[model samples]
Target: MAYATLEALIKQYGLDAVLLVADRDQDGDIDADVVEDALTAATSEIDSYVGVKHRLPLPQVPDVLVRVCGDIALYRMSSEGGQLTEDKRQRYEDAVDYLKRVAAGTASLGLATPPEQETSGDAWFEAQPVRFGRLL
Candidate 1:
């Protein structure tokens, strides 16, 4: 699943801003595919960094990641729409910087590490007592 949804993006950047950057056909509405593409790409990028520390496909989406993903996806859409602004660029950079910090263990996702599996180098076998044995 994508780290950020279109609703999350709209919540962060406003619906008009999303449409402005995502309406590639000039249809006066948000193109779901366009937004999904950006969000999917952003999610993959997030995984690359977050995977270094956390497991793939986190059990729950962090609020921080949702905001970061929104920023990254919005930056991507703006760049594709030829409307990239300094603020969008800076937000993208900041998101990536935070991801780097996460990868470097300088930042926290507040998720507990999964327990490691246990293994042993021993084996044993058991057998039922023979029923036909003669009494001593």
Candidate 2:
């Protein structure tokens, strides 16, 4: 993802505000320690700290997914700026569609699997070796 491009789009489209939904156990508070950890963990040059307008704490993974989907919908529907042009409109639509699928998947997983166990962050890191090949 191009952070500079995304930032430009946000400014051009007046999408200055964003609502970030994350699991309460992970990102409830914007503490310096948390920020530093995220910075250390980030694999891309794009700043991880950006795009957070308001942090909505969620107790469960399903709840977090639902809230994020809702937030994306709300942002797309907001009338604070002019109607989005074709390219921007398509981008927003694509993002919302992807998020919807993610939310559905998360909900299904939450239902099928025990809630007491969540995938570890290491699982994500381990997959990256085979998934992304190498970081640019």
Candidate 3:
């Protein structure tokens, strides 16, 4: 994943930071040092983001929670086919549930509002018509 893209996403969403976690699956061995290096590079490129390596116990993996401006956008990045698993999906749902519980009270991260759409410089040009005739 490109760190620049991640940074742009954060900025567009007005998020404080994003949490990244990774794990290896059964029969899949990866070099910890190499992974660490990649993670370091990603963090260096993106500000306020933290990466952590976790070892999941049998039948379960760690849930990832990203606290952005008090609202959490949770995600699960699975090593298996690099797809999100049901457990992680559930975790994300649970996070939303928790958010509703404490929405009325104050929190350390603060309440997060809905993310705003990012504007592009050439957005209008893309939708406008172009002159095809030659202009002397």
Compared with the true structure, all predictions reach lDDT values of 0.90, 0.32, 0.32
What does candidate 3 score on TM? 0.24
Tens-place lDDT per residue, model 2, 91-122, is 54654554445344432323343232345434
TM-score of each: 0.83, 0.26, 0.24
Candidate No. with top TM-score: 1
- The clash count of every prediction, one per candidate, is 0, 0, 0
Model 2 per-residue lDDT at 79: 27
Per-residue C-alpha lDDT of model 3 across residues 68-97, encoded as one tens digit per residue: 211222142233225455655665466455
Candidate 2: misplaced stretches above 4 Å? 1-79, 106-136
Give Cα distance to truth, residue 70, candidate 3, Å. Answer: 15
Residue 17 in model 3: lDDT: 20
Model 2 vs. true fold: TM? 0.26
